[model samples]
Structures are given as C-alpha cells and as structure tokens.
Target: MDDIVRQALAKWPDVPSCTGWLLLDRRGNWRMRDEAAQAGGAAGTPIRHTALLAFINRNYEADESGQWFFQNGPQRVYVELAYTPWVVRLSADAGGALSLTDQAGGVFEPSAVYVDDEGGVLFVDRSAPPRVAVLHDHDLEVFSDHAQLADDGVSGAFFWRDGVALPLQAVRRADVAGRFGFVVSPATRA
Candidate 1:
C-alpha cells in the first residue's frame, strides 16, 4: 500500500468500496468497466494510459478472503477478475522467464506451478501474503516447451530446468475455486 493512500484512508475513513467498475482481462489488460459494459456483459475498455495503468497497478492488492481490489487512494475498488487474480505472461526480455503479472500489471516471481486436468496452469507465489495466478492459455505453448503431460494421461507436471518435476492436480475447471481457496466472483466482500 502507498503511504499517500494510507494517509487518505486515515483521513477519510469511510469511503464506500467501489465494485464492478474495473476489470482485469485474461490477456493482462486492465479494463475500465462502466455500467453499460457491466450490464451488457462487455469486458470493459482496455486501460491504455501509462500513468493511470501504473497507478492502478501500484495500488492493487487482495484481502484475507482472496478477493482482489485496487486502492483508489482511499476507496477500495474491487476488481472483477476475467480469469484469475494474477495472469502469467512470458517475459521475453528476461530470456523467457515466467513472469507472474497480477490483475494490476505488476510482476512477481512464481514459487510453484500447477496444471489442472484441462491443461490449465496455476502458479503460486510464496510471498508474505501468498498469491495464486493462472497462466494465460495464449502463453501455454511457451510454457509447454518446458513441460510435459505425465504418463497418467490426465495430468501434467512442470519440468523445471533444474531437473525437478512438480506434479499438478487434475481437477475440473469448476472445482478450481474450492481447490484453490478463492472465489471466481464475489457478490460482496468475501
């Protein structure tokens, strides 16, 4: 959290949280969702302004309940996740290292990897407050070069270059929330 945001929160102390106005798309785009977009099932407009994107990314965070939100100075604006709270993108400049891009476009190092039955890849960052993110399907091919389907024919494992094979679960996509301890969408703070 930013010091300025903390000061604002301390000063105002009662601004209602905003919801469904911001979205993080599967492609790592920060979208600005309006009432029309929310009603019409639109994915919101992609945020293009560099300064605004950086501001949003800087204030993005999650609660104890795993609901992700961005601190709009004092007000908490919960993010509508298009996929997962974090979206993993390949960092070409880092020699194709797996970069975990959160809903706000911030990056983190992944400490663990998981693959579901549907070939969905999830990563865990063992930070102070651990976070789990999904690898975007568009980048699966890039990850595939370093992974393989295990002989079970139902699951796969990440073949780390260090010669370590981390086994992953084979769960249905719908079961991901329970298996991962997160809500896909929150009706209220959860």
Candidate 2:
C-alpha cells in the first residue's frame, strides 16, 4: 500500500467502497465502467493511462472474502474480474528458460499448472491464500510448445526450463472461482 493512501485512510476511515465502476478484463486491461455500461452489462471503456494503471496495480489487493479491489486512497474500488484475479504472460530467457509475469509487472513463479476444459491455461502461485493467474491468450502457442499431453489426453505435463515437469491438472471453467477462492463479479456480491 502507498504511504499517501495509508494517510488518506487514516484521515477518512469511513469512506464507502465503490463497486461496478472498475473492471479487470481477461486480457489484463483496466476498464472504467460508467452507469450506462454497468446497467447494460458492458465491459466499459479501457483505461489507457499509464500512470493511473501503475497506481491501480500497486495498490491492488484482496479481502478476506476473496473480493479483489483497488485501494484508491480512502475508498476501496472493487474490481470485477472477467476470469481469474490475475492475468499472466509467458516469456522465455535467452537459454529457453520460461518465466511468468503478471499484468501488474510482478514476476510469478507458479507452484502448479492447470488446463481448463476450454483449453485455457492457469498458473497458481504458492502464496498463503494462493493466487491463480490465467495465461494471456496471446501466449497460448508458446505454452503449447512446452507442454506434453499424456496418453489419456486429458492430463499432461509442463516442462519448465529447469527440466522440471509440472503435472497439468484438468479444471472446469465454472469451478475456477470456487476452487480458487475468488469472486468473479463483486457487484453481484455487493
């Protein structure tokens, strides 16, 4: 959390949280939803401001109930997630070593890899509460290159650069939020 935001919270501790106003899309874009957009169930306009994006990323956090939000100074701006709480991009070093980086620019080392029925890849880090990050769609090809399917076809293994093959488990799209302990839409919860 930012020091300025902490000061703001101390100064005004009773600020009501805002929901249905901000969204984090599947592709890792921060969106600002207006009244019309919220009413119509639209994705809203993408926020392209670099500084604002950085600020939001820096202060992003999750509540005990698994609701993700951006601590905007005093008020908490709840985030509506299109998929998982985090979106990760896959990259390879010069020696063909794979690394994962989240939308917030934080480097993630996944403890497990999962593949949904729809073929979407997800990575889970070994945090206390655990964080599930879906691989960005654009990097699917790169991910496929490092994966090997088992004889059953449903299971597989992901070969990391260090020669460690992480077992790929199967998951259902509908069970993602519940299994990972995150809320997809905070507006509905609110």
Candidate 3:
C-alpha cells in the first residue's frame, strides 16, 4: 500500500468504513451528511456532523469559499472533490442525446445519474455539448511538505492571500503515503 494510505489507515481505521459524504456548503461550513439506508432501510451509524465541523474549524481557517482541511486525530488529511470530464445523456427515454461537460455547468434535463466505482455520481447536461455541475463526489487525497510553524504556531503551507503572505496549514492530509501534496485547485499556491 502507499505510505500515505498506510499512514491514514494506521491513524484512521474507520475511514474505509465511513459510508456517508462530507460537504462544505456554499457558506464554507463543514457538514457531514450520512447516506440513506440501502434496500433494507437499515441506516449505517451516523457520525456527528457538528463534531467534525467543530474539529476542522478549530484547526484550520475557513476561506471565503469555505475551503477547509480534514484531520484524523493528529494526521491532517486534505479532502477535496474534483470535477472530471464526462458525457451525459439527455432525454434518456429514447436513449437520449449525449453531451460532455465538467462540474461547473448547471444541471441538465432528463439526465441519468451514473455512480462511479468510487461512489461519485456523474452528472451530465444534454442541452449543451459540455455539461457543468459542481460535484462533491470523489474523495481526493492531498498532502503537504513539512510545514513551518507560523506566528500563530500552526504548521501549514505558506501562501499569499490578497497580496499578503498567509500561513496555511493542512487541515486534511489527502494522501495516504504522504509523499506529495494533492493539488486540488487549478492555480498553484506557490
């Protein structure tokens, strides 16, 4: 197994067993939403969403977009949702028409939700050639090099916000092996 994955597993044994999804709403607040029961209507154990939010809030600063990191005890796991190019079929009744798009586009009409192996649903837009919709589907792992403590005594990656150098620490270590940091955003921090 990858070192980061092994490390994450060692630290967070319950990760794989975690079935529900975690969300960062438009307000930049953290919320853990549980998945509904299967065919039998048997619900899985529910985790305290508030508890997780409080935990991340205390450890990391919430940006304007409400972006935050995830931590398991002492190890920080960077959790991010990524958008992938996919084709969606509109008007599925008659086998529908197909269009390609990413996560930024709005919803499409008469589209079938395709759940990938990773439990992420693929949203497609039939109206446009490229469909767009924000997807919080995939669990992307990100890591950081050794961080130096800032004036606040927090260790995080150094970045510039509004032209001022800001200290950003890892709230979540997405990588299990911890080799390289996961680059979730299109823009580079450094």
Candidate 4:
C-alpha cells in the first residue's frame, strides 16, 4: 500500500463512497482486483470494510518491477504508469470567472467548464483558436458531457501523434492528465 493510499483508507474508512485513489510503484503495472470473495454470511465471511482493510494491510505488495495493487471489492483497476498532478484544482473569482491549475503548471482561463454525471471535467474553449491547445497528451483526454455547443467551441476530444493535436469526433471517458486538462505551457501553441 502506498503512503497516499494508506492515508486515504485511514481518512475515509467508509470506503464505498470514496471516488478516487492512487497507487504508485517503481514498475509500471499496478492493478487492483476486487472480488466478491463470497456471498451471504459464510462461516468466516468478512464484511466489505474489514476485508478491504485487511487486503490493504497485507496484500499491498509491490513486485521487483514496481507493480502495485489496490483491491477494493469487485473492481480490479489497473494502473500501468504514473505522473504528477493526479488531482486538478479549479478556482473562481467573485465575478464567477474560473481559472484552472494542475500540478503540471497549466493555467487556463477557459470560457466554461462542464462537469459530467461521471464526475469528469470538460473545459470548453470557444474563444481560443481550434488549431492549438495547451494540453500535452490529447489522446487520453475525456469530456464531461457529449453535448455539442458550436463549431467555435473546442472539445477535449483530440489525440496526439508526435505531440501534435488530432481532433477525434468521439468524446473521451477516461482520466488522462498529461494531455486533456490545462497545464502551464511555456508559450501559446497557436
């Protein structure tokens, strides 16, 4: 178990309601396999909290290649790599103007942000030129909702080839930091 994961588990013991958690190892393959273990009250059946905590304390081992796991219950999520700025920070001024900042130092004053039902952040830039975006890894980016506003609006649905942006009509549904969200760019791309 990583120090952050440990701290999260300790802080939020309720478990089910927690949305996000991270595990990092020297190796790239980190997986969390959550199984039912058993159904109903068996002879030594442990509840969700007890079983999860036990697994975290004991089975939280990393291999020589730096692979780690964070099994919750029935969700086996795998993380192949790691990066900084795992969480994004958004601030709004008294006038309702918003500014976004991530760990990568991306500061974007986007026109608006649409938070989807799945709890993802979609920043729409209608004022900026479509030819350039500040996000580094556009391929793994996702959109909060699939609603199309106008041609001038730039959706977070572009992929990268050789560090260049390629627009994709499909909306993204995963969390990819290096590319999608705003970070400080040395200069404007457009």
Candidate 5:
C-alpha cells in the first residue's frame, strides 16, 4: 500500500467502494470498463498509458475475502478478472522459472500445481491462506513439462505431472471461484 493512499483512507474513511469499472485480462493487462462499454457488453479499452499503468500496478492488492482491487488513492476499485487473480507468465531467463505476476505487477511463487479438467493449468500456495492462480493459455507451452494428459484414451480422473502420473482432481473453471475463495467479478453493486 502507498503511504499517500493510507493517508487518504484515514482522511476519508467513509468513501464507497467502486467496481465494474476496471478489469484485469487473462494476459495480465489492465483495462478500463466505461459505462458505454458496459451497456454494450464490451470489455473495456486496454490501459496503454505507461505512467498510469505503473501507478495502478503499484496500488493493486487483495482483501481478506480474496477480492482483488486497486486502491485509487483512497477508494477501492475492485477488478473483474477474466480468469484467476494472478496470471503466470514464464520468465524469459534460461532457467524457465514460472513467474506469477498479479494484476498489479507483483510477483510470487506457487507452492503446488494442478491441471483442471479443461487442461487449464492451476497453481496454489496454502502456506499463508491459499492463493490460487492460473497459467495464461497462450503461455502454456512454456511450462509444458509440468503437466500433461494420460496416454489412455479415456479422459477419466487421471493426469501426469512432472513425469509422475496422478489422479485428476477434476476442477472446473467456474468452480474455482468458490473453491479458491475468489470472486470473478468483485462488484460493489451486483
């Protein structure tokens, strides 16, 4: 949290939270959801301003309920996620470490990995309250060695991870919201 934001929060502690006005796309891009776009059911325009992007990245964070938001100075502007809160992009370095960067440009490591029924890559770290994240579909090839389908023709409860065959937990993309304690759309009025 920024010191200026903390001061604003203390100074105006009764401000109402805002939502449905910002979005974090699957590729880790921040977007502004304007009223016109909302009326037409369009995903907002991509935020391309470098300085504004940097500011938003610095102020973004999550609450205890797992609702991620950007502290726009004092008011909390919650984000609507196209997927999970954190989007993992593989680092360009030779080591090929998985990079979990939040909507805000923060980075962290995942303690465990899982593959959903639809082949969506999942990750989590339960050490300090669980935080679930998903790998961006476009970047799946970068971490191909970490997960795969079983050789069997059936898509039953089975999968292979890191060369070890294991039973598939069979998690759905929609169920992730409740199972992982995150809201796909953190709305102040919904």
Candidate 6:
C-alpha cells in the first residue's frame, strides 16, 4: 500500500467501495467499465495508461472473502475477474530456467501446476493463502514445450530447466473458484 493511500484511508475511513467499474481480463488487461458497459455485460474499455496501471497493480489486494480489489486511496475499487485472480506469463531466465510473472509484474513462484478440462493451465504459488494464476494464452506453446503428458493423456509433469518435474493435476473449470477460494465476480456477491 502507498503512504498517500494510507493517509487518505486514515483521513476518510468511511468511504464506500465501488464495484462493477473495474475489471481484470483473462489476458491480463485492466478494464474500466462504465454504466452502459456494466448494464450490457460488456468487457468495457481497456485501461492503457501506464502510470495508472502501475498504481492499481501496486495496491491490488484480496479481502478475507477472496474478493480482489484495488485500494484506490480511500475507496476500494473491486475488480471483476474474467478468470482467475491473476493471469501469469511464462518467461525464461538467462539460464533458460522457466519462471512465472503475474500481470501485476510480481514474480510468482508456482508450487503446483494444473490443467483444466479445456486445456487451460493454472499455476499455484506456495503462499500460505495460495494464489492461483491462469497461464497467458500466448504462452501456451512455450508451456507445452516444457510439459510431458502421461499415458492417460490427462495427467502430466512440467519439466523445469533445473530438471525438476512438477506433476500436473487435472481440474475442472467450473470447480476452480470454489477449489481456489476466490470469487470470479465480486460485484455479484454484493
């Protein structure tokens, strides 16, 4: 959290939270939904401002109920998730080691990997309250190159550059939010 935001919260502690106004898309894009967009169930306009994006990323957090939000100074702007709370992109280090980086630019060290029924990949970090991140669609090819499927075609293992093969688990898309403890749409919860 930013010092300025903390000060604002201290000054005005009763600011009501805003929802159905901001969204985090599956491709890691931040979107701003207007009234019309929200009413029509549209994805809204993509937020391209670099500074604003950085600020939102810096203050992003999740509540105890697993509702993700951006602490915008005094008011909490809840984020409507298009998929998981995070969308992670796969990158290779100088040593050709695989690594994961979330849309917010935070390094995500995945402790487990899961493949959904639709073939979508998800990475779960080792945090106490583990976070689940969907693999960016663009990085699917790269991910496939490092993964080996088992004879059953459902199970697999991801081979990292260090020669450690992390076993992959199968997950159903519908069960993801419940299994991971996150709300896909916080606005609906309200």
lDDT tens readout by residue for model 4, 1-190: 4455556666765544221233321121222323321132112222346544455534333222333333443322232223312223444456534344432234544444433333344444443331112222321122212233335343443321233332433233343332343221111111
Q: If scored against the real structure, what TM-score would every candidate get?
A: 0.84, 0.95, 0.23, 0.23, 0.81, 0.95
Return the TM-score for candidate 1, rounded to 2 decimals: 0.84
- lDDT measured at residue 173 in model 1 versus the true structure, 0 to 100: 65
lDDT of each: 0.74, 0.91, 0.32, 0.33, 0.72, 0.91
Q: Where does candidate 4 clash, by residue pair?
A: 27-65, 27-66, 34-73, 34-74, 105-184, 106-183, 106-184, 137-179
Between candidates 2 and 5, the one scoring higher on TM-score is 2
Please give the distance, in angstroms, between residue 16's alpha carbon in candidate 6 and its true position after superposition.
0.8
User: In candidate 2, which residue ranges exceed 4 Å CA deviation?
Assistant: 151-153, 187-190
lDDT of candidate 4 at residue 165, scale 0 to 100: 37
Stretches off by above 4 angstroms in model 1 are 91-107, 151-154, 188-190
Candidate 2 structure quality by residue, lDDT tens digits, 25-118:
9999999999999999999999999999999999999998999999999999999999999999998878788989999999888889999988
Candidate 6 regions with alpha-carbon error over 4 angstroms: 93-95, 188-190
Q: Tell me which of candidates 5 and 6 scores higher on lDDT.
A: 6
Task: Sort by TM-score, best first.
Answer: 2, 6, 1, 5, 4, 3
lDDT tens digits, residue span 116-187, model 6: 888899999988889999999999988988899887655989986568888999999999999999988886
Task: State candidate 4's TM-score.
Answer: 0.23
Candidate 5 lDDT, 51-92, residue by residue in tens: 889888888778878889989877899999888877766443
| Cα RMSD of predicted structure 1 | 2.8
TM for candidate 3 is 0.23
Residue pair clashes in candidate 1: none
Report model 5's TM-score to 2 decimal places.
Answer: 0.81
Name the lDDT value of residue 64 in candidate 2.
Answer: 89
